[model samples]
Target: MGLVDTLTKSARRSSTTSSEGATMAAGYSAERAPDGNPDDTEVLDKEEGNLVMALISQLRIGMDLTKITLPTFVLEPRSMLERITDFTAHPELIFGAGKIEDPKQRFLHVTSLILAGWHIKPKGVKKPYNPVLGEFFRCTYHYEDGSEGYYVAEQVSHHPPISAFFYVSPRNRVIITGELKPKSKFLGNSVATILEGEDRVRLLDRPEDGEYTITMPNMFARGILFGKMLLELGDFSSVRCPSTNYSCDIEFKTKGWISGGYNAVSGTVKGPGGTAGEIAGHWDQSMEYKDKGGRKQVLFDAATTKVVQKLCLPEAQQEPNESRRLWAGVTRAIKAADMEAATAEKSKIEEAQREKTRAREASGQRHQLRFFEPVGEKYMPNIGVDRQVSGAPLAKQSPDEMARTVKEWLFGEVSTSPSQSVASGTQATPLPPSASVSHFGSETATMASTASMQSLNSVAAVPVHVTAPGPPVDGPKLSIPPPHAH
Candidate 1:
């Protein structure tokens, strides 16, 4: 949405039903606006703009650093449905009024919930709020440099987050479009914090020099998954990843630990799978293994043993001192997770492609995979109609009733105004023209913010550098401008 919808003081605040009540729908009202600067009014070069334009100009190519970074578990949307089925799974996280009554709906937890800004919610509650009917969250871009500008979302939908924050790039379907660069360093009420060095956060960091040496005291220290039974042992470390999802020649290294528990680490991670000296933290640490080409692998158990010794240092030195030797362990499960996620995403794309092919075959036309569709004067959904209405997608009760939820959620019926040129009887809209799609104007501003944030909290330099390519302005830089004083 534009400034009037997402950021305007007058915009209405809405909420989807809390699992607290059964059959309860969303309640909405105008919300109290936060006292902050407005969207862009002046021309901001990269440094001052908080608008999406400032973060990225164009989508980068190749495997995204984010796609392969951290554990593969971080890639796909979380399974919210499983929790809905078992309220006890995450008792404190439930809040929907509908969930409380229909035990079924509450049990049907989904990954995608509507992003509602209007609902009046109690502070510190984990259940994410959804927006109300007819009320759109307007966004106004205000550069910290005091510049002013405005842009609107393509259209409003149930998947507010997916629509407003991440659209598929018109130039590249694989590229996640739009910018989510928060105007401020952090969102005041975000339930999860990924700051480096903060024990409260799952992951935290502190930057040193040319590199950012990140240390996750115990990554996933207290995480809960389906199979993990009581206090189980897991790997932990930090990642200096590019904000965007694209692949490129990047560098990274981690040095944390492996306590005397069930196989500490087991995996291998190499940049783009094409870089040199590709090192991976593993559990097997096999002394020898043959490759497809029939050559024995180099740097096996011997190298890993040295890393294990380094990790054995006093907790203080292992986590705090870079001089203690920098060698982070990768795990096989972690590597499998990466492979599984990639396969899943690829499968999703391929299945989608096959369906399109069948549809075209039925119509006597060959399927043409066009990644980019011009949004000139019109906005279309990033995924396009090819995927919509395909299969028996839940056209049934609202999203709250679905078996699987997604990151995107909306609480009302969808209706776009001024639409024409019907496709499948319903006029197809372009993504940019809708008040929900076109926020990511550039990626540099996004990375610049990441770099600046790391600079402020880092204690050691991370030799491993990960950055998703941006609109080719001037490449990487030393520093981002200081926050503008109001």
Candidate 2:
């Protein structure tokens, strides 16, 4: 049977016996502002009640959230595949590596850049749709400095929901690759999504040089059961350089249950010896660094850091399985504030995926991942434990070669020969522009400034390298730069 015919038959067969209160007659959409940010108004209380009840029925204190089915209305109008671009939001910190001569200082600068990215999140706490298997997202970055970056992410596994991604900056001669496996558990009043993965950044020109291993902090969806829904990050993460045996530990502290602070983080960067330096600040606000006995100075300011806009192929140019194309109808509906259309379209995708799974099972065939390859062991100390990390290798390649590869992947090739279809031959029609769709200008959020200098009570020592004159140029207010570059 044709795709529409199969879906229509399935819908009719299940329409008569649908569960009570399980399906809403219509979906609810949140009000949004001209800048694309959600407005102060809450989603329809009635619709939210239904979803909350469904969640409460299955929610245990420590229940695994990955297994639960959430209503589509609560989802953000984007896929997890596209969300990974947040890592490259601040390319200056990443590409600045070429100028730094000291390996230790370079390590610190890069690590700071990685930690600075968490503040670039959407204003609200809406969840992104879990990408379907073989789903892919690709976008390019064209910076004001005439630098360019390429990013591509693929959902490599479905069972455990693993995502693999790769990024390259030709101007910086830097490359980043990693896999993500998010494990979510429901706390009594909140949900904790522990990011189980390790991302690595390497200087392409220095192939034989060691890579920097970056870790992700765990996230908490606070007040999930009761009270206002708030998003907070907690737990601890680290960045380690195996070759230099240097490592840094960052602790994300959650606010007190009754009264306290939020978005706070403090850490220490040390080598083989004792403490080398200390970093303290709010991840959403600002971070300050102190080298041993040196005076505290600003390292990053989330309040004013400008995020670079990502360049993406228009919806029409994207392949069928690409994230934008596959979710176009749903995204368009969400953007238009048509929650009913969004939910209906989302259901179609999910139903189709279920059918594909059944067919593959009956044929005893397994879905194979394209673009990314599974690695035997990609784990670092506190990163993903034994989880498979899959991605293409960062082979030795000239800048020209890497650029060509990325271009071919984003745009089509010139060869007239036929090739394999993209992502199981699935196709979706594009949705037309609607009045609800708003192109909101970018807005910067000011993180609460709760971190104080008195909190810097750690032991202090003199800074070894003193070549830096001021803070990074990206943020004018930040004054303490890392060691000088070559």
Candidate 3:
């Protein structure tokens, strides 16, 4: 029998009621008495058993979950596109690049900023939706300095999923381009996801060409077999600036077999002439920096920093393909604790996508990526030039290699000006000033330079200024496109 059929039979054998099979199929919550509390110990135990059976069935289907259809209850109410915004939580670190001339200092600041951007959800185990091919999400950030920054992310590939993102700040004259290709493996009790791409940050106005290349650490979903589930970032990652000869190696420490540490990161920043700065801290909390002078200072404190809020048009005004707009029904259902409704809505979208894929295959057509194109082995903007820089490559090595590297840098002698190597196997060129201005998303080609969102029905209302200024206000009004003709 099929896995679903076996699971259904198992559910039926658990209880006398016919509703038990239906409940298991729908991932129903434990029944409650009129008082709104759980019904009884027997009912609770049976419900828990059903869930365990379902989880077992899911694992039996596949060890690699990349292509599997996960239940709606396990999904977080957001898309991967929305999750990428965590990088811009602190606008100062990005926009402040223009003020810092020293490459070493700038590299240090950028590394600290990148480490600070990892935000954990309230429920640590919930997963974000796997974006559909050609799906796009866009939003803008209004900084306290009255300057605006825009971000765009697209799911540029499907077979081996890849997310391409670009964030441009005209006022700061900085651009961030990245491709995310995660390779995940499910261990018997835990899952490991390795980041298989590099991200580049370039300052457009800098006279000397330089770019910061960053690689993220691997992630782990632990405690799956028993106990409370937890998400932990493991292994190590680094940030390097090739032109400046300054580099930071960040080691994310995972807990050991017996006991060691969790969320702990320690690294050394090597600059020109053997000068080094020490960085050590917990990623979700705060980090400390000891400069070449050996004076220690708090680099970033997530607990105290006022994270900038991201702004996106309301769902009603968002394009059909925007993350919020596409997942509105599923999000509503999840929020209301209606798992059945959430599953149904999510299935509808997935089924539509599958049908489209079948049609494309039959017609010998392909789903064209709207916002990004494949660059080398990853997806990046087809437009724009690059600014070349030198830096040591962020190599993927075993834990022992990383430990030895860190130990040599810390206890043993090492070169201050390490020879630079390309992380993406190519040099990044900076975009020309004219090319800096671009649109927000694929559906709504609204000018990115415009502060106010374009409205189709009437003249856009004057935005009320708050603690921070909003987007620029001088462009033709635009509105969300009507739903795509499916």
Candidate 4:
């Protein structure tokens, strides 16, 4: 039978069964779970299969999917702004990276930290909710060593769908700032989310080593129209530090039709002199590093490492624009397996956003961002840091003072009591005309060109001698400017 015919038959078979076991076999039990964690292979129910078929009929081979409204079943019950926290899941790997004396070791530690993050995602082919403009998410991390980390992220732009975020662990002397602009497209039976952005990591204690810029790999959702839906990271990514002249080029290899394996990655670490080492293994399991001397060490093993829990205020305590509070109704409906109610709740948020956009266009007002500010084509944390000051650099600030400043900047006030609720800063303004109600812009559609596809496949061939200021020859180019240029 043809693929569509087989799906239809399966749906008909499922429709005839009234038993709870049959319903679970059709993925009903998984859908009703609060977390909605699916197995590696997701089985769509009759209703879901029909809905997906209808949606697929409307899509072109290489069409941009940013503006398309996806089914609620595919949602992960969290905003993209909050989902970005997955990158910093393992605080143990990142907190002490800067303290490593040797540049090569530090670079390797950073690479391991990057690779470790990809394994913490929710199982199944799921995507986080596209955050609305001006919506924000913030949380705190309490490390085992008694130190704390703070993270804040905001959807600063809507049309291009840019999420700017900041993370700092003052006691650990680490600061990370970055932006994510995800451009999704329908590629035949698969969908790809081109991760267009970079993370700038600064080791406050090791200022002389400078900042490390890390690029991201693109995400691919395979077998969307047939077979079992699966998520894979494809193409090239890199971690580079200019001051130390050290870099690591990583390739997230996708599984081929009849060969290859899922989550496989290979990388080369280069220093100022030449190639320093090589790394190989699966990103979701374990990775190993080998130095020039043939000395090998396990870089990261996901099975042994525990992800630190993040603390967020209760939904009732959160501001109206906070990610959890903003999507509470939709989340509750999804958890209860009420697709109709979920759709209605989701539509309310989307329609409210559209109304705000229309009102802004009519009033000729631009969106006023809360946590981040645009610096040229990039965005930076608006922590009120004065670079013009003669001698006092940001690196010299005490950890307590730095944390206080960041807290005030994010919450609009500094509170000493841990039990006190921190109010979210000023009410958000509507986005500008260019940043419409659409999730992403027209530029995303152009990213599916032949040239980009070729680049994605040839990542291993990229030259190692490239400097931090220059973009890599293979894969998606990083758009972040040089360190401290802002």
Best by TM-score: 4
Cα error, residue 192 of model 4, in Å, equals 0.7
Ranking by TM-score: 4, 2, 3, 1
- The global Cα lDDT (0 to 1) of model 4 is 0.68
Alpha-carbon deviation at 4 in model 2, angstroms = 40
- How high is the lDDT of residue 357 in model 4? 99
C-alpha TM-scores of all predictions: 0.18, 0.73, 0.70, 0.78
As for TM-score, the candidate ahead, 1 or 3, is: 3
Model 2, 234: alpha-carbon shift in Å?
A: 0.5
Runs of candidate 3 with Cα error greater than 4 angstroms are: 1-49, 58-62, 382-459, 462-486
Over the stretch 423-452, how does candidate 1's per-residue lDDT look in tens digits? 253323222121111111121122111222
Cα deviation of 432 in candidate 3 (Å)?
29
Model 3: weakest 10-residue lDDT segment is 32-41
Q: Can you write out model 2's per-residue Cα lDDT over 1-486, one digit (the tens) per residue?
A: 543233223323223323221122111111101111133112224456455555555555577889687776667777887777777766655454544455656666677776777775544456788999889887655443333566778888878988888887764578788888998886554568989888888865455556888889998765333333566788888898877777899999877644657788999988877688888888877887787778565556766666655545557666788898899999899889887898899888888888989999999999876566676654221111123222233244444454454555444541211111122333311211121111111211121121221121111221111101111223211222322311
Ten-residue segment with the worst summed lDDT in candidate 2?
26-35
Report lDDT per candidate.
0.20, 0.60, 0.58, 0.68
Query: What overall lDDT, based on C-alpha atoms, would model 3 receive against the true structure?
Result: 0.58
Q: What's the distance in Å from true for residue 198, model 3?
A: 1.8
Q: Candidate 1: minimum summed lDDT over ten consecutive residues — where?
A: 109-118
The alpha-carbon deviation from the true structure for residue 387 of candidate 3, after best TM-score superposition, in angstroms, is 12
